[model samples]
Target: EFIIESRDIVGNQRVIGDDAFVVEVEGPSKPQVSVQDRDDGTYLVSYNVQRTGTYHVRVSLDGHQIAGSPFTAQFHPGLVMAVRCTGVGRGLTRAYAGENARFTIESRDTHRNKTTSGKKPFVVTIRGILQVQVHALEGDNGEFHYSYRTPRAGVYFVGVLLDGVDIGGSPFKLTVDPGPAHANGCSASGAGITGGYTMVETFFTIYSRDYYGNQRTTGGDVFSVEIGGTASADMRMRDNENGTYSVAYTPMIGGDYFISVMMDGVHIQGSPFNIASDPMPRESYLEMYRSMEPTFKEKMEKMLLGGDVTGVKDRKKANSRRGKEAAQQKSWVLNIKLLDANRLIPKDTTVDGTYGTGLVQSSDPYVVFTMGSESVRSTTVLKDLNPTWNEEMKLPVENRLEKLKVEVMDEDLQDEDDSMGTAQVSLTDLVIGVPKMVTVKLKELNEV
Candidate 1:
C-alpha cells in the first residue's frame, strides 16, 4: 500500500480539494490495483500479487506521474508453517554409508501455497546407529536443501523442524547398506600367518570389509593365496559363508616363505605374513640311526624321554678309552651324542604365536648336524624354551673332515627356519673308544 499528498501550482497545500489519480502495477505479472482519492488532496493505492517477487507501481495525476510515483514494491509469500512443508527427491530415502545424502524441502504457508524463507528457519538432525546434526540451505526459488553422511550401515531417521515446530511427518526413516569393498578396508589374520612348519599344514583367516571399514555381512569373495620360498609349496582358501575366509598351506623345505593374499586381485591388509620353518624330518635321517649298537641305542631312547644318560657304562658299548691311534684301527662306527641346549633365544609369534590371546607362543627347537652331503636332523621339540635331544647317531668314519657342523634352529609352521646359532665340534682331539660330553656354545665364532 502507498499514500500520496498533492499541492497546488503555487506550492500551496490544499486542505480539501478534488484531484484525478490513476494507479498502475507491473512486475513478473500484472497485479490488480485500486486507487482512492479522498477529495482532501491525498490518494491511497493498494495491490494484490500472485507470485513472490518485486513489483513496480506507477501513480499518476492527470497526465504526469506524481513525485517518486514510479515506485518499487517487494513481494513475498505468506506466513509459512511446519505442517505444510515437505521434502523431495530420492536421496532423502536411501544412500550409502560413506557417500553424501542430499534432499530438498518445499516450505509452504498455512494455505499450502509455496513460500519464501528468511534465514535459518528450519532445524534438521539424524539419529539411529549414529547421531548427527544437519544444516539446510534456503534458495530464492523457495527450496530448502539438506545433506548428510555417516560411517555405519543401518536404519536411521531424519527429523526436520520449521520455526521450532515439527513438520507434518517430523521424522523420516532411511535405510543404509554396506558399500563396495576397498583394499584399505579388507584384513587378514590367524596362526598360520604368524609362522609355519616345513612339510606341515598351517592356517589363517581373512576378513572382507566395505568402503566404510565394516566387515561385509555376506561372503563369496574370491581370494588368492601365494606362498614362495621353496619350489614345492601349496596354499588353499575357503569361504565360511560370512565375511571371513580360511587359508591353509604346506611348505616342502625349511626356509623363509613369503605369503601374499589378495581379494579380487587387490591386496588385503597385512597380505604377506611370513614363516620360519624348522628343519623337516626326512626318512634318510631316520635310516641313519638304524645301524647303531643296541646298548648305545637303548641309552639314547632313555635320554630322549628326559631320562638320565649314563654314557658308555658297559664295555659292550665301547672297547676302552682309545686315543687317535684307534682311528687307524678302522672303527667304522663313529658316534656323536646330542645333549640338551640351555638358554636358547626365544622367537616370538611362532606356531605357538597364539600368545596372550588363547594363542600359545615360543619356539619349536631342534638340532641339525651337517657334514658335506651327509646331514642328520634330530626330532623337533614343540614349544620348548630349553630342549633335550640326548640321542646318539653313528657317522661314517671319514678321514677327510676333522669337525662336525652343528646348528641350533627354531622351527616355524609358516616361514623359514631361524638359526638360533651354530658351532663346529672338533673331532680330531676325541678318544675313539670314549663317550664324552662336549659343551658347544653356538654363536658367531670365527673358524680357526
Candidate 2:
C-alpha cells in the first residue's frame, strides 16, 4: 500500500480529488491496482502481486512528478503457485506399446522459487482402455520422474497427484501406437456351396496378419487359391482393404473339390479344404432305419445275453467307436506355461479425437484355454513381456481330434480386451499319463 499527501501553495493542506492524482505501476507480470481518494488531502494506493520481481510505482499530480516521483519495491518467493510438467521429454504425448515413456514435473512458488525440499510423494496413475501402474524414479523433490508401459492400444489418462490433491493440469492424455507389422498366419472362412450347377458363384474370405498380431492390409497380391478335384472353377481374389481378402469362384463341374489357399508363398492353416460341387443326395429316414435294423437286432440280443452290446462286428468301426468313447470318458491333464512373447504385435484404438498407438511397456497379459465349447482363463500377469504361469489343468477331451486353443490376451477395463496371439495343439500329439512341457508359439489372427 502507498500513501500520498497534497499541500496548497500557501502552505495550507488541500484535499486531493480523485481526478487530481494518478498512479501507475509496472512489474514483471501484470498486477492488479486500485486507488482511493481521502477527504484529508491524502491518497491510498494498493496493488496485488503475482510473480516475484521488482515493481515500479509512479505518482503524478496535475501532470507533474510528486515528491517521491517513482518508488521501487521487490518481492521474494512466496507460497506454492503452480506445478507443471517440464524439461526434456516432459510433454511426450505419444508412444508405442512395449516402449518406455517418461516425463518430468517441477513446482514453483509465487516468488519463482523452486520448491524441491520435502519428500511429498507424487502419486501417478494411468487410466484409459486399461488401468496401469506408474512408478516415479528414485528421489522426490520439486522435480519428479514418471515412467510406464501400456499393453493395449487406446487413449490413456495420466494423472499426477501432489500432497493427495491434483495440481493444475493433473491429468495428461497420450496416444499409444501398435508396433510394426509382424503377421505370421492366415485364416479362411466362407459359405459352403451345396450341389450348385456349373457357373454357380461361391465366395470365401481370408484374414492375414503378422506374428505380433498386426494385420496385413497391403501387399495382398501374393495371395493365391487353387481348386483341384472334380470341380474346375475360375477363381478371382479381391482385397478387402482391412486385412482380409474375398475369393469368388464359379464351379464348372459337379463333384468334390479341394480348395487350397496360400499367402506370401506359404500355405495357410486348414488349407486344401474339401467342398462338394454337387450336394450329396439325402437318404430317406425309413431307408436309413431299415439299413440299421440288423445291427440294432444284434446289439439287442447281445445286451439280453449279458454280453458287450457296444461292440461292433466290423473291427475298424468298433475301434473308431471305442476311441471316441474313451476320449470322452478319460480326462487329460495339461501343464501349460506362458513363458514369453517375441516381437508381439501392438494393439491400439481411438478416443476423444486422439489416435493412441503402440504397445504398453509392461502388458498385463493372461491366457485362455479353449477346447470344444468350454474355456478357462489363467490369472493375469501385470506389466511383463515375459510372463510365466506354470499352471496345470484337467480337461475332458470329447473328441480326440479336437484342437486345444490357447489364446493370449491383455486385460483392460474401459474397452474390450486385446488378444496377443494364439496357438492350437492337438490331443493326439500328446502322450496320455505323461506331463509334456510344450512351448506353444503364439501366432497372429490370420497366421498359420
List the candidates' TM-scores in order.
Answer: 0.42, 0.39
| Candidate 1 residue-wise lDDT, 90-164, digit = tens | 667787878777888788766565775564367887887789556565466568788787888876777788878
lDDT per model vs. reference: 0.68, 0.62
lDDT of 1 at 268: 78
Which residue window of length 10 is worst by lDDT in model 2? 280-289
Q: Write the per-residue lDDT of candidate 2 for residues 1-448, one digit (tens) a residue.
A: 9777777767677765555787888887778778788877887888878666798888887888777778888876555544633333533477666567887766666455556665455677888877877777865556767788776655687777666766556567676665433324567765532224344466776766554453354444456789878847888887755566777787787777888887566677677688877521222221122224666646543534346755545633654565557556636444544433434454543233432323335466777888887677888776655454645455545565678897888888777899888898876644332223344667753221
Candidate 2 at 30: error in angstroms? 4.2
How does candidate 1 score on lDDT?
Answer: 0.68
lDDT of 2 at 333: 42
